[model samples]
Target: MSPRNDIQNIKVREERKRQIMNVALEIIAENGFANASVARIAQRAKISKGLMYNYFESKEDLIINIMLDGFNQLTLSFDTNKDGVLTEEELHYFIDSSFETLKNNIHFWRMYFMVLLQPQVYEIITPYLEKTLQPFYETAINYFIDKGYEDPIAEMRFFAAMMDGVGLHFILDPDNFPLDGVKKKMHRMFK
Candidate 1:
């Protein structure tokens, strides 16, 4: 058989990268970023340590990628229209899907929050987090402005704080967390 073409090569590369990332996320989530070394991640991923570097420059790069992946997943439903504006329907959808994502990916979010709680890890990820989340932050603020809130920034802050609180509460106590009730209340309040 002929060797893999460029398209095939790209596909293989992406798949391998994804496999490595998925494994890293789980290991970091389970082991915490401080302890989840690149060698450990590579071992968990069943890939050679040298091969892991071929995909990511270093352990920091690997975790940054994983963190961004979770952040992207969290914001996947935001501004669905791609118009750079959050509509009413989009707000409701974001509220709805945010809960859905939390419910569906608790372990990942748990790790995401765990990483945030680590001061050193948070410091390492802060710059990237700010850069990665700036667009969504602006869009969310714009959303409040369009809604004609008296203090758009404050409103946005309140909404964000509440949402984060809900997510954290659910993560801490998924079994007893009134997920549906909170979702409905959010929809009502934001409605």
Candidate 2:
């Protein structure tokens, strides 16, 4: 094929892959991961099952890839300072940006939590999960240590738990949650 034709073909293929993943995200978000069958995803994407397979090896692969994408999105949203430390200003930025991301991609976050609740799904994405979270985890621990806090590890865990609680409340009641108030309170806690 000509170079131009090759480029066009590549674009088409990427678009098709994105379409399939998008449908898969919606299906899994609306229904549990177990309900998100390959056939169902293909049907939702209006593509053949065989064609979907051409893009993804299996339903597990799709879910893992989607979770990885969500992790990437999260890292992109949170800005860490140049020194690789979570300064007070950076902490507020992280909180605000993360809340913004949750607001914008509420469905994806729902799907993420759904997958997280499934024990089996954990095995599939654990490596990626640890790698993705390591930086933030280390940063929090280091920040606490730098602040001369006793039991820095425990402090970091408390910080993580606090963020988890915020996420849980936001996810459970996105429409009614006092997100700004919560953000301010979180800032104070970390500050």
Candidate 3:
């Protein structure tokens, strides 16, 4: 094939893969991941069942791709100061940005939380989750260390656990819960 033809073929393949992923996301959102089948996803994407195997190895691979994409988007949305230090304002911005993203993609977020609730699914995605979270953890620890805070690692881990717990609470009961009060509570922890 000519170079131009090769480029066109690559573009077509990418578009097809994206279509599959989008359909998978929709199917998994509508039905739980445990109920989402490759055949169902292919049917939803209007593609042959065999064709999905060309793009993804299996349903687990597809689900992981969706999660990895979500994490990448989350990391991109995070805004830190240019000096690699997070100010109080930047920390608040990060929390709000994270909450808004989770809210906007509630389907994916729900799927993620559901997966975590199951040990099998959690095992499948734990490596990916760890890889995705490592940077944030490292940054938080380093930020405290640079500030001359003692036991930076422990402090950062506590902060991370608190943040994760608060996020889960908000996700479960956003109507009755006031997530905006989290920053105040966190501030009080330091005082």
Candidate 4:
């Protein structure tokens, strides 16, 4: 194939893969992972199961890819600069972006929590979680230390745990939860 055709083919393949993943995310989020069969995802995507298989090896593969993509995007939002260092302003940005993402993409958050609650899925994703989250963890700890915290590690842990709690409540009761109010409070505390 010509170079132009090759580029076109690559773009088409990427688009199709993204479509399959998006459908998979919706199906899995709405019906739980056990009910999100290849047939169901394919039906939702308006593609043949055979074609879906062409893009992903199995449902497990598809879910993993979706998670990896979602997490990478989340982390990227936290990282306003690609410098691997978290400034005070960047930390605030991360908190704001994280809340916004969680509020807007509740389906993805549900899918994540559902997967975490499943031992089978959790085991499969453990390595990916470590690899993807390690950097952010390190950055948080280092940022605390740089700010001259007496116990940087504990400070980091507390901050992270608090954020997780906020996320859980936000997911469970988004309509009633005062997300903006909580965000402003957190900003003041962290700042």
Candidate 5:
């Protein structure tokens, strides 16, 4: 058999890292962030303690990556073309996709909101999340400008807050969430 190439090796590493993060997220969701530990996560992931460090510098780093990835997953549906502006179609898509993501990743979202509820934990992640979401915010603001809003920044803030509230409500009550109704309303409102 041929030896694995660099690309294959990179894929392997990425998958392993993802596995570790998934386990950490599950542990956090089940036990809460404060109770989750590196040793426990590593055990759950079936990786040695030393190897876990290779993927994550520390528990905080792992948690930060999961949080950042969760936000990025939502933002990815926005500005799909990487252009500075967000079109109406993309705006609609973003709203729809955001709800879909919440429905599909309840555990991660639950853990995400749980972490944010604790002031100290939220403080640890605030800077990282702001940095990651900066570009997303810029594109959204540009979208509001294109849509002819008088105050694009305020418009952007409103959009963000709306999304946050919807997500929190869904996580709090997925079974009773009017997910489709909310998505349709958002689409209509945005368009």
Candidate 6:
């Protein structure tokens, strides 16, 4: 096949895969993953279950892909322009962007939390989670270093842990969690 034809074929494949993922997310959101069967997803996607198998090896594969895609979307929302400097405004932008991404995808976050509750799914997802989150961790630490922090890695890790803990709390009880205060606290960090 010509290069142009190869490109077109790849695009078509990616579109189909994206469609499949959308349907999977919808089904998983409506019915928990344990109950969201491949058959149901195929029906929802208006495709054959066998066709889904062409793109994904199994249900677990589909779920992992969904989770990875979510993280990618979140990561992309951050500035990510590390030019050896990070202004307070840029830090605030990162924090707000991160919070907004999570808030916008509450259903996806719920699905992730549910999956984490399952030992089997948790085990399968652990490696992928680590791989996806490592870059964010590195970027955050680098941002701190650029801001003249002496021990950027240590500070970043501490802040990362705090963010994770607070995020989970907000996810569980948004009304009581005061997520709005996060932006203020983040501002204080820079000040």
Best by lDDT: 1
True lDDT of residue 68, candidate 5: 84
lDDT score, residue 46, model 3? Answer: 92
- Cα deviation at 159, candidate 6, in Å, is 2.3
- In candidate 6, what residue range of length 10 has the lowest lDDT sum? 77-86
Runs off by more than 4 Å, candidate 2: 1-14, 79-83
Q: Which rank order by TM-score, best down to worst? A: 1, 5, 4, 2, 3, 6
Please list the residue runs of candidate 1 whose C-alpha ends up more than 4 Å from where it truly belongs after superposition.
none
Kindly list the per-residue Cα lDDT of model 6 for residues 1-191, writing each as its tens digit. 54668888899899999999878877766677788899999988889999999999999999899778866775674555755344566667777887887688766676556555566666777899998888777777887888788999998888777766766776787667778887678668766
Native-referenced Cα lDDT, model 5: 0.86
Instruction: Write model 5 residue lDDT over 66-96, tens digit each, in one string.
Output: 8888788888888878877788988888888
TM-score for candidate 6, residues paired by index: 0.73
TM per candidate comes to 0.91, 0.83, 0.74, 0.85, 0.91, 0.73
Per-residue lDDT over 74-111 for candidate 3, one digit per residue giving the tens place of the 0 to 100 score:
66544465465666566666666777777677666665
Off by over 4 Å in 3: 1-19, 22-35, 79-88, 187-191
- Checking candidate 5 for backbone clashes, the offending pairs are none
Better-scoring candidate (lDDT), 4 or 5: 5
Candidate 3, run of 10 with poorest lDDT: 76-85
What lDDT score is found at residue 182 in candidate 3? 75
The candidate with the higher lDDT, 3 or 4, is: 4
What are the per-model C-alpha RMSD values against the true structure?
A: 1.7, 2.7, 4.0, 2.7, 1.7, 4.2
Off-target runs (Cα >4 Å) in candidate 4 are 1-4
Error at 129, model 5, angstroms: 1.0
lDDT of 2 by residue, 1-191 (tens): 54668888899999998888788878877787777799999988999999888999999888788878877776664446446777877777878888888888787787677776677677778987888888877887888898899898899888778877887789889989999999989888877
After superposition of all CA atoms, the RMSD between model 2 and the true structure is 2.7
